[model samples]
Target: MSARRSARRDLRRLSGVALTSLWLTSLGLPAVFSAPVSAGAAGSWVGDAPSVRLYTPGREVVSQPFLPPGTPMSAEITSVSWRFTPPPGSARLETRLCHPQRCLWLATPRGQSRALAGLAATGPFVMRFRLPESARPSAPLRIEGLQLIVNYH
Candidate 1:
């Protein structure tokens, strides 16, 4: 009778451990395999007849552009800015843009400049460009060249 009782207790403990492990596995694996979801909807605007594409953390790419010439052309991204809050307990905001010739790195800085090297694939990416102070909204900026390749991981 004591042997039977010991076996029953061991089975109960094993069942409890198995259920706990299963629950943990279900909760942990989705976060590991899936992409981080964004908190709010992404937005876009066009300047100088250029195109804008925004990729949210939920793996949705929103493409918006004002094709002035009625033909598809590369949009000059003068500025890109956004606020991101990453998931808890892990580093987030790894985004980048790459072209055939080079890549550019975007950072949260207060200035206007061009990126010398290819874009880095990490962090809170913010970019600013030097546009003429007198530039008007109606004035069409020539953006017939270049393409923007965006990525986030």
Candidate 2:
């Protein structure tokens, strides 16, 4: 009798789980029952130059590579994003992100903030800035409140 009760209980539990998964699927959500959750180390840091008042065309200003936000010495980076004041007029500002191994350039600005993709690394990473010679700013171009955020798991 005890063994029969245990088997019935197990069937009920399995049926409940299957029903829950089907309900979640109907709602277009993942069935996360007993799934392992991944932990992430993600944070933002101030650039070595918080702001640049001097606008030197065609010169690359490099910031010292900053340490990872927490304990992510060898974690794979998943994303990069930035916030900064855009250069005035037609001046196109560019930013470069580098790990010891390689670099990636963020896209030209359509606004003050952007989330960029295609960066993968385990980092202590460096940042570089440039205003190209082709840019024709009617006013002085100043970069302010430059910040970088790194995300990894």
Judging by lDDT against the true structure, name the best candidate.
2
Q: How far is candidate 2 from the true structure (C-alpha RMSD, Å)?
A: 11.3
TM per candidate comes to 0.21, 0.52
Question: Where is model 1 poorest over a 10-residue stretch in terms of lDDT?
Answer: 63-72
lDDT tens per residue, model 1, 1-153: 699999999999979877777887888852233456553322223223133232222332222321222211222333333322222332222333333344344342212234522232221122222223332333322212222322222
- Model 1: colliding residue pairs: 103-118, 103-119, 104-118, 104-119
Candidate 2 C-alpha lDDT tens digits along 18-125: 999999999999998665445554544333335654356787876656665454454555566656666445466677766676776767532222233333444666
Candidate 1 regions off by >4 Å?
A: 1-75, 92-94, 99-101, 106-153
What's the lDDT for all of these models? 0.34, 0.61
Q: Which residue pairs does candidate 2 place in steric collision?
A: none
Cα deviation at 111, candidate 1, in Å, is 11
Runs off by more than 4 Å, candidate 2: 1-49, 109-122, 136-140
